[model samples]
Target: MKKWAIYVVLCILTPAIVKAQAVVADSVHMTSKKKVPKVQYGVASFYHNKFEGRKTANGEIFSQKKLTAACNTLPLNCWVRVTNIRNNRSVILRITDRMHPLNKRLIDLSHAAAKTLGYTGHGLTRVKVEYLGKTKPVELNLMEQPAQP
Candidate 1:
């Protein structure tokens, strides 16, 4: 009877011990690397009319004409600088919404913001973005990264 009890206790404790070990390993992996956020450049299109006036992830109604953008990991009410390399033009947009659920792009700009960069169709454009290190009320200004060929 004592041996049976011991075996049962071991079976119960083993999983908990293993789980603790896994948690420690995961913590080590997360802490060992510096998390530098990399900005991605790609072909992005704006959403308007359909999504305008609708509630955004930031709990504000989306506006197609606003100088605003949606980002995945950027905190709400941070500013981001989006630049178009082809024309050397850029727009400073407040991060007023979260990223699109199905997209891997860094940001989703409003229609007016996209127009600032002269993007009309789906094609690759050189872009550089930097997160403004502030929170609400957002300061929509950031230094633009030099265009990469």
Candidate 2:
């Protein structure tokens, strides 16, 4: 009789326990998902000729010929797509530096980037900056190794 009672209790509790676990698992999965990318819209300007060789916030030498940018909010080394709203031109640039504390622009692009977006002459243009996540580090495989020295 005791065994019958224990079996009845388990049968009544099993479905409830499984359902609760499923709910918990779903919540965990939702929390583990990656966050959505961020997007911003504002005016964008390019670096001056005097800033061509200076060191950026990320310790990289600033180059006007490179497709890089300085952003106030985005993380360094992340890639973003900057679109010129006036001419509908777009360019992908890496955020390798930070803007000044008082700078109100959305992003400061390199001269090459601004030229590619067709806004070099205008100096500043309305832009849409979309975060494209961080750049991945290069991975090396065993096959690519230099072989036992």
Candidate 3:
């Protein structure tokens, strides 16, 4: 009867022990290496030109000509590639500000970003966003990656 009780206890506790170990291992792995950010899809909009020269939520001056954006939850300063779903046009932008959680827009692009995606006049566009991990903000070539030899 004692052995049976011990066996039942092991069955109940082993999963919790294994899960704890796995969580620790996962955190260590994440800190040790760079990870690609996950892709997200949503509607995108451009900031009004009036917002230019105004201070952004992150303390940087907003520029209609800069390729920067606002996101609901992406970490400040993370780079993302926004692709227009209808025309397949894409532009890379850095997330420099936060969107209000109550806002319906998934992402808000700067005027330049909206122009690059060919949607400034239309106002809103459906877009797919690919998080490119954290890095210093710099404009990269928007061309597709070269095919492997």
Candidate 4:
């Protein structure tokens, strides 16, 4: 009798325990809260055929076709804009993972990201990055004007 009672109680409590463990971490994001780091400006480029489909600094495997980029310090899932000073080329990409840990490279651009910025052949370029803060939706008024604007 005691054995059957124990089994029933165990089954009843198991679901609640599992539910508590699940917290949907919607999006892992990082941004420059206090001050922006000193960024290098110039030509910037991305990895192409070589690193396509490889694992990125983030946990998820990388897909070159995605508009994603890597950063050294920016938080995960954050967005950044990289502008090539040489030719006025610019591209905005999301922070998919931590940047190359050992290198001083500011950001690693995906093939698509590099292509968007006109950095196909060079493989690398000097660029400027600006953190635009976190993602948030603006409230529209009756006049179709954004609340924050």
Candidate 5:
């Protein structure tokens, strides 16, 4: 009878024990706030082909087709406008990961962004990046306004 009672108690307490362990594990991954720079100018590069499916710093799967970029210190999930200073082409990308610590570039672009900016051939480009804050609705001037009295 005592063995049966102990087994019941163990079953009742197991879920709470597992939940507490989960909380502890998640706490270790918490990231502190990071400030985004208004504008930055430097050499930019792209994510290499080997890291296509790896996990990014923000916990998302890396996808070269997405308009994403990486920075050393910018806040995750924020958007930035990257312009190729050579051809004056620009594209907006989200900060979804971090650049390699040993990398000396200012920002790392996604493969698609590099291709769109006409830098895939060179693998690196001189670029200007402007922080656009977090993703938000973009207002368009072409929308028809209400008629005024």
Candidate 6:
């Protein structure tokens, strides 16, 4: 009789336990979906020719010809997509430097980047900045390998 009672209790609880697990699994699946990238809208400006040879925050030599930017808040070495809202031009640039503490611009793009985005002439333009996560540093092996048998 005790065994029958235990079996009855389990039969009633089994479905509830399984249902709870399924709900948990579904919630986990929902949470595991790729999160949307963060986007920000603000004014953007480009570095001047005088800053061409300066050293960036990441120790990289700042170049007006490269697609790089100085952002006050974004992490160094991370890639970001900056779009000029006026012309709908976009450029992918690496965050290599930081902006001035008192600067109100969202990002300071390289001259080349600004040119590509069709905003170099304006000095500043409204832009949409999207955070694309950090990029992996490339490794290069220069040594020649030995011949295998």
lDDT of 3 by residue, 1-149 (tens): 99999999999999999999999999998886544458888999988778888888889999988989999767778888899999999988899988778999889999889999999889999999998877743446424456569
Supply candidate 5's per-residue lDDT for 64. Answer: 95
RMSD of each: 8.6, 13.1, 11.0, 8.8, 6.2, 13.2
Model 3 CA lDDT for position 94:
92
lDDT, candidate 1, 11-101, per-residue tens: 9999999999999999998887544354646555566568888998778899888888887666678767788878878877788887657
Q: Per-residue lDDT tens digits of candidate 6, residues 49-70?
A: 8988889899989999998999
What is the descending TM-score order?
A: 5, 3, 2, 6, 1, 4
- The candidate that achieves the highest lDDT relative to the unseen native structure: 2
| Local accuracy of candidate 5 as per-residue lDDT tens digits, 117-145 | 99999988999998888764263122335
Using all chains and alpha carbons, the TM-scores for the candidates as numbered come to 0.60, 0.66, 0.67, 0.59, 0.69, 0.66
Give Cα distance to truth, residue 125, candidate 2, Å.
0.2
Cα-based lDDT for every prediction = 0.74, 0.88, 0.87, 0.69, 0.86, 0.86
Candidate 4 segments exceeding 4 Å error: 1-43, 48-50, 136-149
Question: Which tens-of-lDDT digit does each residue in 86-145 have in candidate 2?
Answer: 989988778999888999898999999999999888999999998887863233134356
Ordering by lDDT: 2, 3, 5, 6, 1, 4
Model 1 backbone overlap count: 0
lDDT by residue (1-149, candidate 4, tens digit) is: 99999999999999987766553222222332446553545334465576766776667788888878877677677667788766877766678866557766777888888888887777777889877545621321233565674
Error of 1 at 96 (Å): 1.4
Leading candidate by TM-score: 5
- Clashes counted in candidate 4 amount to 7
Candidate 2: 10-residue stretch with minimal lDDT = 135-144
lDDT-best of 2 and 3? 2
